[model samples]
Target: MWRRVTSLSHLLSSPKSSPQLTPTSYGPKIWETLSTEVSKKSGGGIFSKERSPFITFVLGGPGSGKGTQCSRIVETYGFTHLSAGDLLRKEITMNSENGAMILDTIAKGKIVPSEVTIKLIRKAIESAENDKFLIDGFPRTEENRIAYERIIGAEPNIVLFFDCPEEVMVKRVLSRNEGRVDDNIDTVKERLKAFRSLNLPVINHYSNKGVLYKIDGTGTEDEIFERVRAVFDAWK
Candidate 1:
């Protein structure tokens, strides 16, 4: 059922190009059209007011420990963990229609199109039985944030920004042998550059919206989770 609704048939025939790394590469018209089609097919948006889940956007640079903390949150609080990166990686491994595109974008340390990422996220949310969700490594750009709001027709309940030093983040990424294509020094540097140039604005936007929690990510795993735990506990 989900496969039929979330199929990438529309994008499969798209011209092959190194996806532009800029935030405004795709216009609002595209999102509006896709959103409308999705809404019509689903009978409504994926989320409705009464059933709207508790959503926390977990954000951080590479190796900022957001993933580890998300695991802790799921264990302690029972929120369903949804890592956008993991979802995209699964697409690549499964050789889905969007696999090659997503692989190229990630290798270049660029973001996948909001349309593709958002559909994957929506499918995950719809399939899950849990109401509360921890969405990690998403909305890496203002465009991503806007597209999500426009398509999902809802805003995250809170946004978590794991604040960590560049030096610390780099050191951690270099040491952690995750065997990911983007884990190399060059790719990690590129990811940091993209993060600073793109992700920070999304953080500031959420901060201005008063839903952003800036957590100090420079500590032992337990220490950082404690800070993250406090934020979730308050929301609880």
Candidate 2:
């Protein structure tokens, strides 16, 4: 199972403090949360410019290995990967009533209310220590995109879509051993259905606007990552 790069509790304890980016005990299969001793150029670590900072949104259906690819990018390039789902899941683990409700909602494969999700996105972006980012498993709706535009004040410079077949996704999810409540077949099916019925349009909108790039996701993990690497390496 892939655990979070680190516990946010550790980060929150010393807020505004840069702890340290230790060598990751977990392998390269996960995003390694990192902190630096020195404050970077910008207080938030993500630079503020007249236009948007360098950012990319990773979009894909379940089992398309979006998380795996994000991990790879964080390792090879110096981009921070912010997963909206992981942050919400951590809130659940905190065991507050809020956490419990979020955990239950996540397991059900429904979207968390937009305000709740947007609040989280704002905080995560503000805490970043890196300018480049690969945000995964997010903007699952047109509403999600609009909220980001309204709150983050910038849209993504690039959007990467991992295009995989439904059959392949089903088999991959069934075999995925993370033990995530949402990884179950029933939830997987519902999520997929919801993604196609609801989320594909957001993807298409980006594609039409010339900001979308598609990578073939039918191959092995290494093969899929190679495609993502090409897209990101060419990032300006």
Candidate 3:
């Protein structure tokens, strides 16, 4: 799936998973899209700088147990978890035009607009009350990464990829019972296809940068979380 995001296909594919969802590799290419442009408002005081904390980009497809692992990370560590899906879903709930499109696209496993997705991520970053953040379910495209570097101005400390098979992910989503509109098998299939499409390139971006960490995604929630914790432990 991570492969699809970065080596991403234009069209949707089958279901899959990658740590909380690390199945693929990421490298420097994702950052290649960065432009030299910077906005003064978001540039945030280049003269008198505070310490820049490392960011952890937690990436995965839907039902990849990212949320579960994020909870564990928050409990043990103090990093904030910013879920892109949750943010988009919130927009859908509010009945925004973009939100409506996102819901439709996600249900069909299609990629959302990079600009819209990045805008949501930027919002989360600006509103962050803490220095450390675990950005989840974002940058599913090279474009996503570029937008972040362009708009957000910070690179990730590490990129965590959850490695799980498509079959496993499909089963998990079907049984998830979260009452999400995108959780049913039909929509899940589309979501999975979209996930496969966007994830490869994203993963490749992180892997090439040597920041990608792959972890087995099969098992109970605790088991999966333990793998995630292990990454943080080594990093910390």
TM-score of 1: 0.81
**What is the C-alpha lDDT profile of model 3 across 113-199, one tens digit per residue?**
878877886677666767567888878878788777776666676777776777888888888788887778877777777767877
Among the numbered candidates, top lDDT falls to 1
* Model 1 C-alpha lDDT per residue in residues 1-236, reported as the tens digit of each score: 00011111212122221111112234335534533454453346565433445678999999888898899999998989999999999999999999999999999988899999999999999998897799999999999999998888777767777888899999998998888989999999999999999997898778677567677788799978777766655433
Query: After best superposition, candidate 1 residue 160: deviation in angstroms?
Result: 0.6
Query: Which ranges in model 3 have alpha carbons more than 4 Å from their true place?
Result: 1-42, 45-48, 51-53
Q: Given candidate 1, what's the lDDT at residue 193?
A: 94
Clash count per candidate: 0, 0, 45
lDDT (0 to 1) per candidate: 0.77, 0.69, 0.68
TM-score of each: 0.81, 0.76, 0.76
On TM-score, who's better, 1 or 2?
A: 1
Q: How far is candidate 2 from the true structure (C-alpha RMSD, Å)?
A: 13.4
Once fitted onto the true fold, the runs of candidate 2 whose alpha carbons sit more than 4 angstroms away are 1-52
Q: Which ten residues in a row have the lowest lDDT in candidate 3?
A: 1-10
